[model samples]
Target: MGNLMEPSSASVYDGNLASDRVVIHVTSHQRIDQQILVKWRTKTFIARIVEDQEEWIPQFLTQAANFCGENVSRGSPKGSLGSGTTLRFWIDTWLEDKPFYLLFPDLFKLESYKGCLVKDRCTGGGEFSQWEWSWIRPPSTPMEIQQLLTMLTKIQNVTLSNQDDSWRWNADSSSCFTVKSMRIRLQNASYGPTHWVFPWNKFAPHKVNVLGWRIKMNRIATADQLAKRNISTTLSLCPICKAQNETAEHLFLLCPFVDYLWSFILSWCRVSTQKPCNLKDLMEVHQKANLNHWTQKLFQHVILSYIWVIWKTRNDSIFLTKNPSLRRAIKDLKGTSFFWLATRSNIPDLNWEKWRTFSF
Candidate 1:
């Protein structure tokens, strides 16, 4: 197929958030691609729903649709009830996690218009008492009456507003959709029991966590990984120790230089500096300590800081200063750990003295 939008006359939008959003206004005679249409609907349906426009969104946008109640939500400004014109009364999870169809299956079966919009059923100035039901028959049975009354109680506070409704994408703080947030969400969803969960510490900077994650995934461009990719390097030895060929395992955990650094960190944390067998063992070292939850977390933070500092020191030795200082790396690790805890952690009394002697 010639480009779907190219052959047809359409206007394209370019804006600040344009990377996350694509708007194409095509001529009436032009055809739209089905796959592209699905993708577009998946991303843009929330915005359409917010605009109070009735549109039939496919259920196969399953992940996105499922997140409508959990990761995304209908929101309105202060003193506004949010419009419900576009949201299906019994389909979309505007009120709760599961849609009303699942929540009240019997009532759903009674609904005359199975796919009616919220605005269609709500007639009296957005009051729960004024619900105009399009049912095959009014609730005659006791169970049906009880369900209707329960539903009324649940939606008593809900009211439509003159102002337009808004969709909040909870994945991002700004409540706007981003590729990064979506990727993280999908990754978390796909994680299995066998999958190695990255030891994420909130006290460490995001970059440090990313590096740790990369190391765990064997995705970092260490010398061995580079060689595997058929990239030539003049020297593939450990940049810090100049001993073994640089790999994630050796560079971060097994190198003599790194072993000494780990020893220093362990001793400072008041733990025995037993040599870790592998990267996994090194990561789990913090958990072996007989400490409280907070202390264990702090120890993990220290370990992550050490790895981050060691990687930086190795890089600087190769590219920047061309000299590797064990003392400098140790100093950087302590400073980074202290700074991260003081700034990112909730430790109110985490001063240099307490941090220096593992007294937290």
Candidate 2:
């Protein structure tokens, strides 16, 4: 079965391919740290903008703003308009979880001062406070008049404090930012493939099951995947066949060498095998075979073992400069499945003899 904890890889990219392979997997903790770091960066960037008042902003900070803005508007890190010195009157999301410009586009067009803050329009403090709107001309159209009246009604119960505006983290019950809360929120927001749920084989080891899941999710670090992550690599072609650029799909399912290995394994299992179009299809191919439930599950386990062996061999080819041998891979696949069944599975009296002949 797959572990309750998911695997995450963190790497600092230099130029070297070998250096890029130094990954750290810390289960859920690392992802939580990453999410917290993003929030912290956004908070820092906003603070700097308020204090420094810099004219030139960096591209990364702009990205942070957009990321923060989207999440903030979702009512997580919601801003409360107190004195509203820090929030823009028209742009910042202060009222009704949206900016005034978005709520009243026609009225916003007629505003004489576009850069006015929330504090700029409030006439007085406390419950008697009123909005002092500045317009280039008075509202003439029906839509503009209606929008103004609606906006006024929204702020009718206003109670402005002398204190400055503040942001509240609504992701948690306490309205405070914590790594655990943020991580849970992020986990809830996480999505997977709509069509398939990962079939965790109880017979396979966790690492092997994880490998199969990664292959299905296309999360493996093949050349194409690395390129997509903007990591430069010297090698692009498959180490085994030296024919096509390495990808999860190509390496696991579509590669000619892998196809032959699958044929060998399936033939050994006494199952009629047809080449699957993708990793998802490959994972489910055992179900199409005419076998008993025990044999079907065992067939699925063997498939995962085969995939794990292929990946191990591929890694060997890349790192040790070892040639990929079909015999060695099949041998490794057999050994792995044998160990898994003997130790992990409920298959009674499983031995190497029965395993080799598909007698179990």
Q: Scored by Cα lDDT, where does model 2 land? A: 0.70
Report the lDDT tens digits of candidate 2 across residue range 1-360. Answer: 011122222110111112111122324763455455555664454444433442212222223333534442243444577776766678666666556787899999999998897878886765576889899999989999999999889888765777867555455566544434434554444334453677789999999889888888888999998999999988999998999988888888889998889789877988886778888888888888888887889999999998889889999999999999998888999998899888996777778999999985
TM-score of each model, paired residue for residue: 0.49, 0.54
TM-score of 2: 0.54
The digit string of per-residue lDDT tens for model 1 on 85-180 reads: 666778765666556787888899899998887777777665443578888988878888888888888877676766654344445565444434
Q: What C-alpha root-mean-square deviation, in Å, does candidate 1 show against the real structure?
A: 19.4
Q: When superposed on Cα atoms, how far off is each prediction in RMSD?
A: 19.4, 14.8
Deviation (Å) of 131 in candidate 2:
23
Q: Name the runs in model 2 displaced over 4 angstroms.
A: 1-84, 88-190
lDDT of 1 at 271: 76
